[model samples]
Target chain A: MAHADMDTQRLDLPEPMPQPRFQAGFITPYAFIFPALLVMLGGLLYPVFMAMYLSLYDWQIGLDLEDAPFVGLTNFSRMLTDPQVWEVLWVTMRFGFWTITIEMTLGVALALLLEKPIRGASVFRTIFILPLMVSPVVVGLIWRYLFDARVGWINYYLGAWFGIEPQIWLGDAQLAFFAIVFTDIWQWTPFIFIIVIAGLQALPSEVVEASTIDGANWWQQVFLVKLPMIKSILVIALLMRLIDVFRGMEVMLIMTGGGPGRSTELLSLHIYNRAFETQQLGYASAISVLLIVIVFAISTLILTMANPMKSRSDV
Target chain B: MTGLFKKGVGALAALTMSTTLAFANPYEKYEGTTIVVSWPALSHFIKAEELIEEFTEETGIEVEVDALQYLKLRDRQLLEMSKDEGEYDVVSWVVMWKGEYVSKGLLTPLSQFYTNGSLVDPNYDINDIADAYLQNGGIVGGHKGYMPGKSGAMYGVPFGAETSILAYRKDIFEEQGLEVPETYDELRDVMAKLHAAGIPALTSRGKTGHQVTAGWLLHLAPLGGKIFDDNWNPVINSPEAVEAAQVMREVVKTGPAGIPTFGFGEAAAAFLQGEAAMHLDTLKIAAMSRDPKLSKIDGKVGYALHPVGSRCGSETGGFAAGIPANSQNKEAAFLFLQYITSKAGDQRMVELGGDPVRISTLQNNTEGFDEYPVVAEQLPCADPDWRPLIPEWNELNIDVLGQALTQVITTDDPIQPIMDAANEKARAIMEREGYYVWQ
Candidate 1:
């Protein structure tokens, strides 16, 4: 066999063919991953870099490229002085705070209330989650028509069924803020509810049974045992809501158009208005940059509170 | 494994295909090919796109339509011109950016088109166009502005024009023992009566910026405040202007419940559905308010000028179209703009929601005009101030006016602060643009 193999060597050199730098393992893995890395860098990282770069320049979107006068941090400084910017930010924060707080409270309550498989609980759960499925714009439009002072179904009832003054739901600043907050809570509470309910269901029966054996009441069980166990899930849910809160201006833009006085003007809507309507592209970009920072900082805080990586590894 | 790889590649390819961004048309060929013109979110552009097939048959040119928002369109215009790149052959510039659009080195001069007597399609008369529109408005960016086009250096000729007229519910007016308010005082009295009757008198502005600026502020401020001085310092936010804004606030109080929250579309809907007793807008909405297809109160609408204060007249708010300096099809775009601006185009629009400025259109009694006496006389009666050329106007209107208007309309806060802020901003913007900027 050795003699036959030696004969079959043909024209082999004494040093033999040098092995490739990497056998299939290292090279093959990178070959598999390179396209993905390229995509991440190109799509996500590039835009972020561009947005940050643009934030520094006094740039208009459609103006001459040569015309972007670099104003250093003046755009950012102007934003700090701009009352409208701060007002819009305040509106956004209030909107986010109300929507998330109410949503979280109601969501947990509903999930706990319905966790027990009672008659028609499934149907009720299905109905509860339905509003979340509808598009935000559709939701806004529906609410808009419903809230119309003259023609809305809401006003019709106020006029006919009850002797209530027709509230300008989308007009007066306070009412408009409440209207947006209520609309958001109505749509998003189900998301929290669904997550919490799932977390409740996943709890070990032994833990529950042990709690029952200890003569702990239902309220105590929920607050003490169940809530502590599902804190991480709750945190995740809150984090998601926080992300959405930053981007919550679309519904307001459609419903109220950021009007009756910048009452409903959230940061996002303000940025959009400045960018498109005003053509102050540089100012708009700076605001957009601020918005990104705000959203990122808030999101980071929320995520760190949950620390899913830390919590999940232990679990 | 091969199939998986192929599927991944295909998915990536599809993603790339879907997002192929619009690029400059390098080809300057103007064969029997059709090109499209567009306006910011109006129905005319939609119809224009639909008619491309017919145009293709007659002219053998391929055309398409693009309907963008007003701000988006303006941005597109500046960008396309800066690159001197043409992607479209026609554009809709109704009553838009002022004559300085010609002076700013942005547009191609149509003086040659005018001299050649090919200014319009033969079926359309060149004489019928309002003289002011031709003389004053036709200038832009240091050139004698040509009519609006899809691409080229020329600005767009109006495909349509809009001047706000009072739209009132006839039933409510009759029941309230009121005639259409012809003057500001009468409008006030009539609106108060309507308010007493528990009917919303108007559908005021909230969502959109220009809606209130044009429909409300421009209307009242011109009547009360000094409109255009000998020196073109716009003092529309003067004490008189404040009085007018206050009047608007008071008047808007009687409008639909969410009036301050309403944009044009909502306001129109509210009026058409008999929610608002009156709406102040152009004849363009006359068709919509009359169309049984959409309007609930079709033919139940009436018209009059928005109540004038001390002044004898009204200001105009109209869109304009222009070609980008970089258009690949300059000649074709120019032809398209001229064609659309001519009588034939106006008449065609007359059948649709066209607000014709041609004398012939008003004289001929277009379809809806014969039904209403005011329509017959209205087109010619409109005041012309598509006004003195202002360069910094883009910033003035969009940044200064729009911002203040939004602040006022949306929040019921101090109008003074917003107005003052706007005035300051407007001054800065105007000064930046090298206009006569007063502190």
Candidate 2:
């Protein structure tokens, strides 16, 4: 009778709910993620892989894909040896250095100054981001017109306000480079400002109070407590801005066309001119691969050094 | 019995209608077939768009026009041709694109249409087009693909024909006591005088790439500089080329402050605003410079032949229309091409302040032609091959020569090294394209 009772209890236990099959659970998670994974593979990975494959061939614009001759590593080696590539890369580096340095400095300084809840701060913030909202192409066109020696409003304003002579803003190599950099600063500084301001506002109030209780001054509180707390955000912003500098070409394309002797020809613009203007699709693809590797390396190095999420766990 | 009789009558009427439809118009078979025509957004294209309705009404074929920027048009045409079938039946291209288009087999040879009497209108006289314009634009590699007349297969018909000309401010020149310069030396003297007199002189395209190169070629070609020699050796760094560069430098120095960055539009704007004393550009600008609505210096501008250097002519540059080889509606496209470039079309173009490639239209001696006589005179002297007529010429002219010219104008660098470097680069490009014989 006891054995019969034990069997009845086992039957009443509902078969342990079928053990919640591991395979089904595992597949459910993946099935939920499958569509996005497919999108990533199609949009990003496929193009990257295709570009890599194209880098091995000597392809011209008008030729059929099959007709393009396979010339493995020739384009890569040629790019490495090419002086124009070095020049363009140097220009890109210099542009990135100047633009990023100015933007970060101005951005962080503005963020620190305007972090307090002041009257009309929202209006000022809106005004600051106006340039950011304008299209890059439109920005380029606007700057081009303003920099025109004969008819530009910039020259007119300078002459009228400062009693300065009209300047050739986009003619000389140096001036054209300066013009593009200035335009970039005007357009991108607000992006950093908005990011850094958000970071500043999100700082823990307790940490700030503790710093204040320890007799930390305004500079000390900002440099030591506030900045360190938001180091990850700054690093991420820097990384994004760096990527932008490498990727940007439209503004320069419209303004200078990498001209006055390629003084403003960024690496990306050089790749574009090589592919479309010169019809060296294979070589351009190879250059693009090199660009991607450079960007990837820089990004990985930044993430490793800063690790934005690392501070979250520590806090 | 009455139903049978009525059915027979209906059948006979249907047969008669079908016969009438077959013999109605040459393009009747292609009726209701919509064809897309792509060209750059220029005045002539606008004129074509205005007249496209007439074409549709006459043939019952539908036409859609896509007016894009010059570079965009080229890219679109190239992308379409690279496919098995193209979206554009009629493709309008710059004269410089002829060699590339032919070499890539992007254009259909129009000889078949010419031979087929029913396809072409009897009144569409190919001989009406100027010989220089016809040869420079229509014929490529001994094949005529577009316009009828002359040898080779017609690949394209001349749409808006243009050659470089010297446009000077008559009022400014008169006030400054300057005559139209005939030689490079005289041009320099005139520019110097104008500069000393506190007047800007000689606005030309100085922006790098095709703009600067086209401007430079105006001087380079007349200075007896050849882009290449008989064996395809680049002679762009020759003494004449250096002289041409020097001349360009002197001229640019006397012009606007941002001369190195000035494109065709900017240069023209400066001259038309009466700020510059002289402008060297296409003949099409002559009309624009005289237009009361656009130009501030209307009636103050005078046209002349481009200043003579070692030679006495100007570089030819213009747009042409061709039927794409991959066009699904080649017959309809050809009809459109012929209709636009015909005598009536050319007349319409001229009336709309656009340049005409037809000799009869140009010689009309009417109000438009009377206003700009230099175009007709300069047409005879236009150098068809002012730039190299090769598939690689765009890179050589714009990327190589354009860069070299930019350096020449912008820097104090010795012109010879720049020219030599450009030549070397051009030669390398040619060799890569199998233009040179390998030992």
Candidate 3:
């Protein structure tokens, strides 16, 4: 057998046989993905398209869609000059900035603190994620109760523990804005904490150990090695929250109803008020188109930063 | 023998006719038909729901009620009525929304049903319902800004009518030697004294949107403020309106610490929980004030008519029931409406914590009337045209005036500029809605 193998190796091998370009039916791949594509079209694209379509008409509530007068681009042009729209857009941006900044910072710090197995760590982790489990509407109510100017636990403790005067947390515009921001942080930090901690725990221990052996300090290890490795996860979490900031309005709607001169009125809540409160369905749809574009641009910009096709080692 | 037979046959025929007429059932034709009613989830509606089984048994018609939040009912009704096949057989008509609904041809004129002897109960006297509530709930095509005018058509039946009244802590008033204020000046003085004494004086809704406007509009008519003049020009910044605004500011400033953020719930809580001295709002709050389970100062609460400003005027409007034009079960729906608004039905509602729009029911139901005698007294003062019931009112009252009222209550910004800006905005809305087409 050895002699035969040596003889065969000495001879040149024939050129490889040509392979067929197609192995299966052309429709098979598309068939596999048809359901998902259909879902995206139905669930995501359809509503957006409908909003754009509705934006072209001068529609009021109780009017048939077919009977609605077509005032092409008028609704869009009106929204451009609507002060309320601009005010609420600015409010949403400010809200997004404060909430995302604090939530990311606090969430990462908490995840890092509890990623290791420590005494009562599980209990603390459980308690931290409890706020995430609560419904957003319920969270709004709970926080509204806490922030009540009179007979609230927050005021009571602030006075009892310190000698501070009670304040109407939801009355003043600035204070109301701050109150909504604080509530968002309390409810959402846990979400970020859960995601970040999962990412942290899943990290390869060998690289961390190597960093430790190379005499890198704890802060250096976190900043240079650990955080850099989880940058993609952090960006994704942030993008999710940023989109949420644009989309969510239940908390603000319940807490302030965009009160004290529209100070706490987020963009989504403003859209709601425009549509239902004012019965300007067409104008509201136009504003909603603006929201979709803003969210799309934000998501695109953030996704580019993450480079999902590349691995951490490639970075 | 022939004469005796003829007399006997005539006698038998007359006897059978009289018996059949006496025992006729008005609800027989609608039996087995099911209707869907969209109503607000208020206290009275919940209680009225318990009596629906009896209605079903008597008529053999099924009722499927969708009890939604009071504010949400309109949105639901609007969408439902817009559809080719309406989801609700009977929809609630908030008084302010009647203009839009009637003008848009969404509701059936109930006069058609009332004129049908076979459909309407003979004993169901529409006149028994209080004129103020009936006019506000039923009439349409009246002069602009006026609800009941020279002539109109009936479109709905008032099921849950209400008016603004004052609820005060009797214990506190007696202790402070405060008399029941009968005028705006007296009320302001009383509130100031109560505030100066370190007590939360007045509790009223100040949250933005319909709530704030509803609270402030209570003073608008009494203070001689009109949203528009005869020429359809915006008059919200008139001197009387400015005074009303001032009165509103004082009420909020001197009230509980969280008054600026108070909705109906918070305002009612402030009074019911013994945190405030007085509350001037819906009669439902007064009714709830007497419930021991709900109110901390239940027995100690006293009710009074709203104080007079320029002239006596109180906020009057509430839920009414009407069949949508597209409703599939219109006959059944109309029968259900007539049944629930009959004298017996109104009395049952009054017994079950509901306000009555019927004069006979209000007079007859004296068993638990001592707690809220102001309900009767305030009826005459509740001007049906208190707020303009135009299609543009929703935007003007809620988005424009509501925000202005919030600004007034929350900030020290000069009231004149805020009100003038509100007036300008109102003018813009009115003009856009074609109110000033002549101009």
| Best by the lDDT measure | 3
Q: What is the DockQ of each candidate?
A: 0.27, 0.61, 0.70
What TM value does chain B of candidate 1 have? 0.77
Candidate 2 lDDT, B280-386, residue by residue in tens: 87887777876777699877777788878877878777887888889999988888888878889788777766778877786785564543467777777788767
Candidate 3 per-residue lDDT, tens place, A73-107, comes to 99988899888888899999999999999999999
Docking class of 2: medium
Ranking by DockQ: 3, 2, 1
Worst 10 residues of 1 chain B by lDDT: B21-30
lDDT of 3 by residue, B1-439 (tens): 9999999999999999877855686676777999999999988888898668879988889999999998888888988898889888998878888888988889998878877878878788887887788878778887773366666777888888888888888899999999989999999999999999999899988888888888888888888888888888989999999898898899987898888888888989988999999989888886787788878987788888889988998887887889999999998999889889998888878777778888777667666675345677778888888888887888888779988988998888899999999999998888877877886
Q: Positional deviation of B406 in candidate 2, in angstroms? A: 1.1
lDDT-based ranking = 3, 2, 1
The CAPRI quality class of candidate 3 comes to medium
Query: Residue A144 of candidate 1: its Cα lDDT?
Result: 87
Local lDDT at B317 for model 3 = 85
Docking class of 1: acceptable
Q: Which stretches of candidate 2 lie over 4 Å from their true place?
A: A1-20, A23-25, B1-30, B143-152
Better of 1 and 3 by lDDT: 3
**iRMSD in angstroms, per model:** 3.6, 1.4, 1.3
> Against the hidden reference, what TM-scores do the models get?
0.83, 0.92, 0.93
